[model samples]
Target chain A: MNLTIREALLAFRRAPLLSALSVTTIAFSLFVVGLFGLVAVNLQDALRGVAERVEIVAYLLPGTPIEPITLATKDIEAFPEVQSATYVSEDSALARARAELVEFRDVLQELERNPLPASIEVKLRPRFRDADHVNDVAERLRGFGFVDDVRFGRDWVEKLDRLRQVAAAVGLVVGAAFAVVAIIIIGTTIRMAVLQRSREIAIMRLVGATNGFIRRPFLLQGAIKGMLGGLVAIGLSYGAYTLINRWLIQASFFSNEQAVAIVGFGTLIGLFGSAASVGRHLRRV
Target chain B: MIKFTNVFKAFPKGGLALKDVSFHIAKGEFVFLTGHSGAGKSTVLKLVYADEPVTSGEVRVSGFNAADLRPRDVPMLRRRLGIVFQDFRLLEDRTAEENVAFALEVTGARRSSIAARVMRVLTQVGLAAKAQAYPRELSGGEQQRVAIARALVNEPSVLLADEPTGNLDERATRGVFQLLRDINASGTAVVMATHDLDLVRQAPYRVIELQEGALVYDSAVDESRDQAATP
Candidate 1:
């Protein structure tokens, strides 16, 4: 082992209580952020599920020729934003109404003549499922000669868009606030660790140890503490997620990428926090 | 070798800690820096070690000038000089041997050679048998010896002791004083700062006295003057 690494590990053994305190402080701070991350991930998942129902339905004119309707379906399908387009004839629409509308099945069955209009249902790609894209696709559908009307629940789509915007803004602001808080807390904790060993630092300097040499062990120690804290936080987050899933509601845990990101965030904070603290101390002394 | 030429040091707030004080120590010479508390004894040592900046004038230690020494060059300058304080200054957690080895380790000495070098210094300090004892487990004299061993492990040319026996009992103080004399006998220059008049009188080494931050007497010059006036 390298001397820096040996010294860093020796510090943990020398002051086990302080080391444990630092790790716990980091872990709890990260746990809060992890909890918020879980909420954001789940919220995004739910929003995506809701957005999948967004569709543009175009009612066809009575007696419209089927040939142009088929051609129109192909044109709608070719639209960049359109994921798929399905045509339902008037007779089939009536049959679907009877099958789906339980209370209206009798009324749909008793129809003397087919009153239901044929329609083309347009489903947009995932990225294009927002209000603007849906409205654009609907306007294009209305341009068809046989399209009598285009309906895609404009108010509902706009509301969903608004909700999405608010969620993103809140997530950004709150997540940043949480991150800053975590950084400050972790920095203070690391500062305390530095202060506790100030005597050792003074001794090292007296013995002709360069500033760089003295700082290396501290940086390594901080990074290790942060990594351990991050792992513990993830474990805590998982436990929370499991409890929520078991008792509160159906919820999902972080994906592998997300979990790794949380840990990397901790490591970076540890590195920077130690750097700032040690840098300040060295300058002062 | 160390030299101070008309050095002036001011306190951070105000007032001079050293006023126009100057002296020189040749290789392998033993000197006593005697003054009451606050008489700039520690200030002079700090200036020599580059622990404090000289307000004005020159302080050259082992060929490094303190007037414009860069921060990075401080460690290099100190590497050639060993410093011990009144408070032993040993890490409480480390054993006597480990404490001495720490000095060598910090200078990036060879890993294979650290153990032997540490033991040699410990034995020289007459604490080889207690190498595994922690500071708390040892007497004041033994702890100070450990500190001396740590200082000597690097084989510095000049050893600076600032009240090295201030916290020791009479017997321990005498013991540590003898060890310093032995170290000096072996060709290492020793500049010991103390107000222990008895210790200063016990040796025939040159004595430099400071009064209120100003050099009052240097025996090397004043004593020669006394002989010339013998008539």
Candidate 2:
């Protein structure tokens, strides 16, 4: 029932069409940003899945004693970057090859001796799963006298690292571009709303209303419109997420904090946009 | 009270709107500002109300100086005066009562007293029965009355009306003129700008006439001078 709030609400009722147009424009613009956010989130998820496969396989020299190998596995597991290290004996290695390599199954089965070497497979922690960290762990593994050769698919790990960097760089640039576009569009819409009510504004000024007083209702109205738009955008994003989940692939929606941030972004845009628009008008007339 | 000393106003694009214009209206005086179109009548009123800046002179209205008035102080100056235009200027979306209350509401008046004050002014303007009607629903005369009521709700010391009856029929014009007179009779000074000579003759108030942005004649000054010369 406050006058500012009352005046703001009155505007919506006075020009429902213009008000609705502003909200819809804001909603669609924010929705685009939200969609891009969804893509960035899912891309990060896929990259993380790929990064998890970066592991160092330290093939042991033949005739290495079991006790030292077991001790070395524990030492490797104790490395800060290493998540876990598993020691695969020669026999188990041969068995795994026969089970996994379908084309070589018969050949592996008829082998006279186990040609596979025992190895310690070291998996790094999520944060450390990168080309540099993998190479560091592999070099450490080679320090072991019995480690015949340490292979961590150097090229593949490096490529994954490059892909993650490119994904982040593109997401940042494109997401920023989308957000800027949203601000401009919403600002223009708010400016139009201000222009639409120029008569009321002139009257208010004629009646001795201060610039601040004149601006309050507009700011409030803009914030409300922006908030509504943000809510609608969130709903739209959720719908898109649901469809993608149902038909395309399992996709995750925005977390609660991120969703609220989107709405907050909208509210801020509305507030500042109205401020700029109204400030310009008040100064001009 | 309003006083202008050698006021000059220039248009933004080009040309002088008012050049060396001067006038003074004391409290409780009803003055008619008469001029043909483009005679700078509205520009003078605008200067009085600080709507337009003084190009090179002084305009002191109700204790606010226009020569150096800050942007923030303009509203304060306006609150002490009411301004009307040719157009009714009422918010079409608001009812007559709301339209009047809007003036008081902007000044942060107490809510408890606004309704009573609005009704009193509406009653004074003879539109009490149409308080709930929107501007679009009211006739042009009735709309002007509502605008007058809004201007009076603040109990202004001076009311500035620029062609208040410009859009009204003869009957409505007479009625609105009578209302302005009544408002003036109650100790509120009224400065009316118009080109209607008929309405000017209907009242005995002093007249100040302008021609092409210059004060061509002032009946108060000229009449007094003529009487002194005849003696």
Candidate 3:
């Protein structure tokens, strides 16, 4: 609608090879970054999902009464972080163990008495399912007289934290590299466009056109290329992610029906945002 | 409307392109600048448009001092003065109509206005039928005409043509000179630099000739014919 828009459209239409090549460069660069982004997001989601499936077991004191433990279990369930908690009495635990060990039932009968401790099995809300939050809650529960021991998986928690730190560091390095490459690609393309249009630019200047008017078409060209490239990258990244996800599901490696919830929106938004950012950077000069 | 007062332009190798050159052209005057090769014919035009600064002395055009003109104001000076080159200098990629419209387009003319003005100028140059043709598709004369049309698109008060017909034949040259005369008659000051002595002697305009960067001849019916005796 605007004059600049007309000029930009003319520039884009005039140079097909240049426009295509520029857009393709942007697409390929962003595709690499987007692909990595999808992997990082899905990995974090998968790990978080696995952590939520683990349950917490709080052992009761040897002299604790079943009624008090049941009351404590109900109170724990009322807490916002606790998903559900069930009281397991000693007699019920011994009976369940004997039924499961039919061969071991004779071995268990050979023992002097049924030997199993009463415990409360607890599940936490998804938000509180991380190892750090679960451990914090477990420590708080241990202060209760009914809770003789509180266990969730301390070693596993520490290991996952270390791995997450490493992954984050790697992501930072890779993201920085991608950003530098994107800038170089955009700068070079713009420089080439400037050189190719130097004569036209000289003539425009001679004809009393301002620098702003002369530079507008090039800026528009850069923006158009960036947007087209971003769209391409998004499409390719999502298509590949879908195929890989389907293959994983068929192989039974992952059971969740929706493995990549954020992939679609995040990838699309990120692609568009980065493309716009590059456009702005190119225009500033 | 141009004034040159003792203007001295020097090249890097101490070559004096114009030595103590001084002249003035009033509104609607047609003038010719003739000289041998490297006699500083184009250099004078360059000075008028502020393309090159005077080494010394004063040069003024359209109320702006060439020496005091800023870089940003150079384009404004150029817009008021049309320049026609020997090579036509048309954008080889654009059509004749587009080339003519380009001058108006750069001055932020509306698309409708540009179209109208370009059509008018192309018709004036007798190239209305060839408006869609590329520079490569036109004859040498037509291309030069297109350049002339571009120069006149802004309706410049002062049109400076440096060998506008250098590549054309005698008939094309006469046609181009006739067009210049028509434009000059219509209140546009025309200054043409050419080496064609016969065209100068035959066409009959105020002639200023330079021999080695010095004005050697000035002949006009209104003038005293005093400088013609000096050289």
Candidate 4:
């Protein structure tokens, strides 16, 4: 093991130009794959947030008693799939609308009375929060006698979920394609290393070196390139994401936690890709 | 000890390299395989090291059949025999010591023992002072000595040299042949292939001569020893 590492380091030092080319190739390919992965992750998060909010907004009859409203909220919350249900008064609804449109705050203050209705908004857990499930919950909420109307965006929620599925599928195909290309590039580099060191290989064979001893240094060299490429890839993609989302004020990108997971996942795949590539050619060496 | 009986070697390009050759080298014997270029001298040495498989018949080294040995065990077979090429085949980037240590390193020798063994072999080849010099920095004779050091470092039972002094001038050739004699004197059997008849005449060891892939003369054997394939 020690000799393998020492020889690999020596081989690495010998081929600065080739090593740089391999690292750059891997970094660029991984950057693309990682960026797409980041996109899918962030989109999935957004879709989940949207799906969880696929609630039935049950507007009560105006001037309804607080007792009935509180009872309905509690009942919805107890449902198996319901995440939470909260009752909002007319004034709080108006305030929320004003918060959403802060530029029109003065315009909203000109209103004589709150135009929004006091309602119970029922939110479902992400697993059960879909068009069909939200509509089923809406149907149950309509049974309340004091409920004036039950409304939910069933069609829009279904369309959003479909979009997310398509996006995720596309991301997977493209990411896998790039990953394969990256692996081939790494394989080619290892092949070059083998050819360049053919004399050394022959000498080692002549000196009774085992196949494992002859091949280990090349394998380690590939793995080291892979690991460095992954790090650079993570840095480039994450840097781009942060630049667009944080520096340029493009909100709603991947959260810090989501970013970390995606980067880690991308780096692992990169490492595996490089290892597999070199391993495939190692037999020839 | 090495033995080849009725060994036949066919090239990939469809010609016989060696046909029904048979010979045996006893322990500590120094034998010279002499022939013109393309006369199958190198093939016999390669067969002893199992570097090339016999087309048919059996060539055994250290009691292992050359053809039937498993691929995994080929290295183990080679570990008992050192090989030196005419070109030296040293890793040009490494120093003389590193080149020598490479043989022991491949055999998984301990680090503490590697330094001592490398020093001993380099000293044996009269190259201890040039241990730190790279191949490019060494003279042609010095480089060949390093190759010999590498081959000897493993303390193999037999040493196979294919034209060990092929590239050397007359003076360097004598030095290399003397070293081979010294190594053989220490009880390791030496099998050397050389077309240099002058060197062969100077050394009083047995000479096996080949003509057109058939054994023509073997100085150590009786007249009846020349029984190779007819065509």
For all the candidates, what are their Cα RMSDs to the real structure?
A: 1.6, 2.5, 6.0, 4.4
Please give the ranking of all candidate structures by lDDT, highest first, separated by commas: 1, 2, 4, 3
Candidate 4's TM-score: 0.86
- Candidate 3's error at B98, in angstroms? 2.2
> For residues B62-144, could you state the per-residue lDDT of candidate 4 as single tens digits?
88987779877878988888888899899988999999998999999999889999998898899999999999999888999
Steric clash pairs (candidate 3): none
Per-prediction TM-score, chain B alone: 0.98, 0.99, 0.95, 0.95
Question: Looking at candidate 1, what is the lDDT of residue A283?
Answer: 89
CAPRI class of candidate 3 = medium
Model 3 chain B poorest ten-residue lDDT run? B220-229
Model 3: what TM-score? 0.75
Error of 1 at A194 (Å): 0.7
> Per-residue lDDT of A1-285 in model 1, one digit per residue for the tens?
399999999999999999999999999999999999999999999999999999999999999989999999999999999999999999889888888899987887788999889999999999999989998889888899889999988999999899899999999999999999999999999999999999999999999999999999999999999999999999999999999999998998999999999998998899889999999999889
Global lDDT of each candidate: 0.94, 0.93, 0.78, 0.82
DockQ of each: 0.87, 0.78, 0.50, 0.75
Candidate 3: how close is chain B to the reference, as a TM-score? 0.95
lDDT of 3 by residue, B42-73 (tens): 99988887767789999989999987898678
TM-score of each model, in listed order: 0.97, 0.92, 0.75, 0.86
Give the DockQ-based CAPRI class for model 4.
medium
> Which of candidates 1 and 2 is the stronger one according to TM-score?
1
After superposition, candidate 4 runs with Cα above 4 Å error: A45-53, A60-72, A88-118, A143-148, A245-285, B223-231
Clashes of 3: 0
